[model samples]
Target: MKLTYYPGCSLEGTASDYAAGIAGVAGLLGLTLAELPDWNCCGASAAHSLDAEAARALPIRNLRLAQRIGLDVVAPCALCFNRLKAGAKDLEAKGERLSFRVWDLLDLLTQPVFLKRMAARLVTPLTGLQAVCYYGCLVNRPPKITDAPTPENPGNMEKLLQTLGATPLEWSFKTDCCGAGLAVARPDLIDRLVRRLYDRARRAGAECIVVSCQMCQANLDLPQARISRQAGQKYELPVLYFTELIALALGHPEVPRWLARHLVDPRPVLAAKGLLEIPAPQASG
Candidate 1:
């Protein structure tokens, strides 16, 4: 199964580990990712707030590129997914009066035929770990932007987790915000937001949080030390990219390498549960 890929800025830079793991697992599962040529930023949150047209146009450009290539696009970032979905929904709804291109990556990947391949390609067996799937804000809120399913309590990630053999935790903060863009401006705000989400995940019995957004993962993983210092308690919850967990199930070689570069290591937990058979490799971060 081949799909056009939009790496966005995060995937090529800070989230390269995730991109690599995803690519590795795709190869192992016989899934092909064709990156859209000349793909640009999806305009993310800032663009949406300032210039809606640019936000829509950015994703539209890539969608049109994908259409020209005669393939569907796959965007791993939750923000990008939300933007693309939003642009596509608007285009389909108003019949081109919006003066912006239209298309969604989700529309392509979730087709019955492709979904069947994705389910069949489930390689990682997350048998023992209980994970809380985190979608943050982009994939759900702002009614016009996302409507693939009800923004509240969507189960796509949970279903995918179950199919990959992981126990999905029933957590209330699954769709809650991790204070993404506020990471730099209002670190305290993010601290509170992350602490709340972490508390919920812990209370719900999740050993880790499975994330599809780079900022969400970084906010959770990078700020734990400060959070612990401020709160006088340690919160060492593992933040695993959804793709990284899927790679482990697919039996990819880079899992260990990816784990090592994390701010909070997940190896000991997987090892303690006797699921850590990933042979260590030279760190690649």
Candidate 2:
């Protein structure tokens, strides 16, 4: 199936691995992705808080562009997905009906046909790996815009994890906030939130946290040492993008390159579980 892909800013920068993994998995599944032309930011966490007009307008611009293409839009970033959906709702409220549909990539992947395709291509199932699926905040909250079945607790990622042969731990804080944009401004608060998530996941026997949001991965994965220090405890848990695990299961060649981008290296845990193989070094002339 071909869809218009809205990668958002994170996918082009810090979260390029996520973009790579998504592309890899899509290729493996025979899904075609056509990027939206000249797409702009969807005005994430700060926009709605600062300027409501710009917040709504920015995503609406993209929605209009997708409408022109006449294909469903697939946004991999949770923040982007939320903003686009919000824009669509706002336009609908104003009676400016949009012709296209917006979908979170996870939601699209969870459909029965896609899941069946993924199952057939699984070469390395993540057996024995215990994980906590983190939804952060914006992905499924404000149910009207996101249309999530259970905003307080989402099971899409867990279902995908299970399909990949990983054990998805049932835990609290599945839909809890991950300190969002405050990661830079009030790290003290962010630390506390991260600590709570990590502590709970560890208690639930989760070796890692899997997430669909770039912000959650940045907060939980990038600042582990600082959060550990602040909490007076050590948390060496790996925070992985759901796409990365799917790519691994599909035997993507770039898996090692994508895994190398994580601040909290997941290879040690993956290797220990015999789920990862270190690529052989290239020879020099």
Candidate 3:
């Protein structure tokens, strides 16, 4: 299906790997993501804290751009999705409305049709890989604003992983804050937050933490070594984007490049699964 794609700020910078996964698997999943041209930032975390008006306005402006394209808007970034959804809610509060719907990338992808396409193209299944899905707040919290079903315990990531043949472990930190918003100003606090998540996930027998948010990935992946050094223990869990794993399962050519950009190396664990190189599927008779 065709849809307007809003990548937000992270995809171009810290989350480029996420972008690559989307690009690699879009066609296989029957998606046509036409980038919203002239799109600007969705005011991520700063605008909402400082200027409420701009927070609403920024995402609204991008939503208008999507409306011009006359298709539903699909924002991959959790912050972007939250911001746009908040803007849409604001429009309704003011008795103004848009012509198109806004969809979080996870919500849109887990639908039956998309799942069918994904299953059809699955040449490799992520069997025996234990992981926990990290929602990182904002995406599904404040459910009235985001309209997420079961915000406290979202199953989108788990369902998607199940379809890919991966075991998604249930954990209490599923929707916990990753401390991304405070990472810069209060790294000491953020470090504690990351440490808690790492220790929890590993204790639950997960080899990695699966995330849909770039901020969460950065928070967990970047400062790992430092945290390990400070604590005198190894918290070596690889924080991975769900898209990266999807691309690997589909044998997407761009998988290696995306995985390389990660700060904490994800290769060893992924390599142990024999997923480093995927063989092209043999032709059917």
TM-score of each: 0.87, 0.95, 0.95
TM-score between candidate 3 and the true structure: 0.95
Task: Provide backbone clash counts, one per model.
Answer: 5, 0, 0
Q: Model 1, 43: alpha-carbon shift in Å?
A: 1.5
* Candidate 3 Cα outliers beyond 4 Å, as residue runs: 278-285
RMSD of 3: 4.4
Tens-place lDDT digits, model 3, residues 1-285: 899999988889878778888888786676899999999999888999999889989998987877778899998888899999999999889897888888988889889897777788888899889999998898898999899889998999999999988899988999988789899999999999889999899888999999888888888999998999999998788888888888878877777777777877777787788777642222110
Question: How many times do residue backbones clash in model 2?
Answer: 0
lDDT of each: 0.76, 0.88, 0.86
Q: How far out, in Å, is residue 127 in model 1?
A: 2.5
Runs of candidate 2 exceeding 4 Å displacement: 279-285
In the predicted model 3, the residue pairs found to clash are: none
Residue 95 lDDT, candidate 2, scale 0-100: 92
Residue-level lDDT tens digits of model 1 in 92-175:
776853332222333333345644665676554678888898877776676566654678887777876776688998988888
Quality of model 2 by C-alpha lDDT: 0.88
In terms of TM-score, how similar is model 2 to the real structure? 0.95
**Alpha-carbon shift of residue 143 in model 2 (angstroms):** 0.4
In candidate 1, position 209 carries an lDDT of 90
